[model samples]
Target chain A: MRILLTSVFVDDQAKALHFYTEVLGFVKKHDVPVGEKDRWLTVVSPEEPGGTELLLEPLGHPAARTYRDALVEDGIPLAQFTVDDVWAEYERLRGLGVRFTQEPLEAGPVTTAVLDDTCGNLIQIATQPE
Target chain B: MADDLFKALADPTRRTIIDELAEQSGQTLFEICSRLSMKHRLGISRQAVSQHLAVLEAAGLVETRREGRYKFHDLNTAPLRLIVERWLVPRTSEPEENTP
Candidate 1:
């Protein structure tokens, strides 16, 4: 089976859309009304429009808050996206006032950095050996 | 306290953790684990790393800081002064009888 979609629980879908598109440079792929207060929102990389979709799920469940909070407290990222150069992306994002929990660090074959998504999640950007 | 410090420094894994922390003062547990497993080639579990951090924290060799929703671990070499005070400093301050 192909993995076409993944999700990160965001505290606010509107804010997530702005950060994912305007700041982090992801393109909006889907946006439909899910319920009274939620939307079926997703974003895809501009480079690979059809590659995969990241669902900006709402933090509707009570357990989700606890789960994400625990992970965030320890600086664990819920989602990771591959980049051309992590250091460059890190610098670019920092210029936009993005708060990084972990700066660009070269660990063995991979280099990564973690930034707060501002929607109650930490996202990781990495450059892995291909 | 001295016993705790020595015991914390006794483990190879713990020492490696200190070495990584020394390289970067403020690091998350996730970052520390990444360094140990990726950079150091250490085959260790995240829970084990957490326990190791606890030991270091008790020894006063590591300190944890809370900033907003995140918690970061920082290396503090202050407790290491005990080693110098207990042995190295005393020897240097002592009058050498052989010099007389």
Candidate 2:
């Protein structure tokens, strides 16, 4: 499936946006008003450009808030994103001073890695044979 | 809202439908059929689209609100968010990338 966007709900919108766009280098696609103290924001990979969108959902809704908290409490990751050149992408992010939780490693046919999002999640970057 | 959204988005047809409904209010089955046909060059019948829509709706990825003569299908974010959160846990460390 062509994933248009991936959404991560966080408590602080400002911090989430800073980490995702500034640190990770995901270009912002949208930043609009949605609700009180909430904004509908999105980003995408520079390689694919506008191919897919990454939604930075604010965590304040009772459902989203509870779910985010519970998942953090359980120490679970929300999701992962695929990159064409994972090793290159890993190094690029590393140069940007981005901290990684798991270093890049070959897992069978797929080369995978993980990073601490600092938003209470570990985002996985990988390249796998479809 | 990534994995479940990705899982919900796993199918090209459904992803196309989401892209179609990206900004618009909503659409009926007939409208969906025409748009998907012209856009994706799909030769599938309306029945096929209906079946696909059923999967989307059943997964809570899409919602159907009753309108006059047809059911207006609108995308739902709640299910996508919930499912992604649920999938965060490995659930006993199953093999990764087993399914698309």
Candidate 3:
């Protein structure tokens, strides 16, 4: 299936906007208004065209609270996404002051790196598809 | 929630059900069954469909709303989107709402 958009819950929109665009190299797509201060914010990859879209969702829903909390407790990534070169992304992200909880580790043909998004969750960067 | 989502998606029948829901926008259980009747493509029973819906709901991948005597099931894009965002979308800045 063609993956369209992915989303994550953010505590603050302003911080998320900067981190995604300035630090990570993702370009802003839409910051449509949802409701008083609520937005349907989204972003897209710079290299890939009409490829992956990132949705900046607001957290406060009980369901998200539980899901995110459970992920944090279990020490399991909520999910993993593929990249062209995990190490390069890792180094690049590191240069920008991104703090990673785990350094890049190789497992079989795949290599992975993880970092704290500073939003109570850990993000995994994988070089190979799992 | 990820487990629930993965479990719900593990079955081909459940995936079919979800695919149908996606195409039709949301569907009542009764309507869902009705559409599946003519096709022998389904591998499971109606009861199984209910169970799948339950799992999906728990995963935050699908939601059910009560309307009159029937319950309408709609796909929740949160988990799917979150899964995609974490991998495909790069961190622009530190994600804002960090709830401890």
Candidate 4:
């Protein structure tokens, strides 16, 4: 009845695992080998380790590349993740050499910033008013 | 298959159409067009709506059936539910002794 998992297609699983876990601060929840070259890798936010999982699914299909490329070219974020503090998280990520497509911007009740996930995805970090 | 499903859903217009269908399932092309325009305030053409529906049908998010001259489109939420069950469903019943 609730959202349990969502996925963002990645070009490389190893690089994505490092960025998502080490830099983005999520914890590896699952990493089961699916085939010879791919794994069912997933990560969850540290704050909600038992909550929703983000699957770092492989971008193996030809259409996936085109879809990701189009979204990136149009400057649309691939996914949005909620954070407690947008500016602080943006600063910390920037310090880690993560390239941002959009700086922190406050719009109405939410503040948001978009950064490249380094795996063919532009991820957005946001903070909503309580 | 999942990639194509996601790709089909990636479009805003297509998402809106899906929303419209969710609101009222088993709608014909004309009914979908009218509802989209009146309810959602989307002034998209019939051809555009048809194309989006085609994509949704291909993704298995929608199914179509012909009743005489009219083709009715129904929302198929099975694929979406399958995705959730595949990764989200907790395997609490299974032993977790292998955890590292």
Indicate which candidate wins on TM-score. 1
Q: Model 2 - which docking category?
A: incorrect
Q: Which ten residues in a row are the worst by lDDT in model 1 chain A? A: A121-130
Predicted complex 4: DockQ: 0.01
Give lDDT tens digits, candidate 1, residues B1-100: 8778889999999999999999998999999999998899999999999999999999999999999999999999999987777767756566433222
**Model 2: lDDT of residue B84:** 50
- For each candidate, the DockQ is 0.81, 0.01, 0.01, 0.01
Q: Rank the candidates by lDDT, best first.
A: 1, 4, 3, 2
List the pairs of residues colliding in candidate 4: none
**By DockQ, who's the top model here?**
1
Candidate 4 per-residue C-alpha lDDT over A66-105 given as tens digits, one digit per residue, 9 for 90 to 100: 9887666534677889999999999999999997755675
lDDT for each candidate structure: 0.93, 0.68, 0.68, 0.80
Estimate, for each residue in B12-48, the C-alpha lDDT of model 2 and write its tens digit. Answer: 8888887766645355554566566755678888778
RMSD (Cα, Å) for all candidates, in order, is 4.2, 18.5, 20.4, 22.4
- In model 3, the Cα lDDT at residue B32 comes to 54
- The order by descending TM-score is 1, 4, 3, 2
Clashing pairs for model 2 are: A4-A53, A5-A53
Model 1: residue A31 alpha-carbon error in angstroms: 0.9
Best by lDDT: 1
lDDT of 1 by residue, A51-129 (tens): 8999999998999999999999989999899999999999899999999999999987899999999999999999967
Error of 3 at A115 (Å): 1.0
TM-score winner, 2 or 3: 3
State the DockQ, from 0 to 1, for candidate 2: 0.01
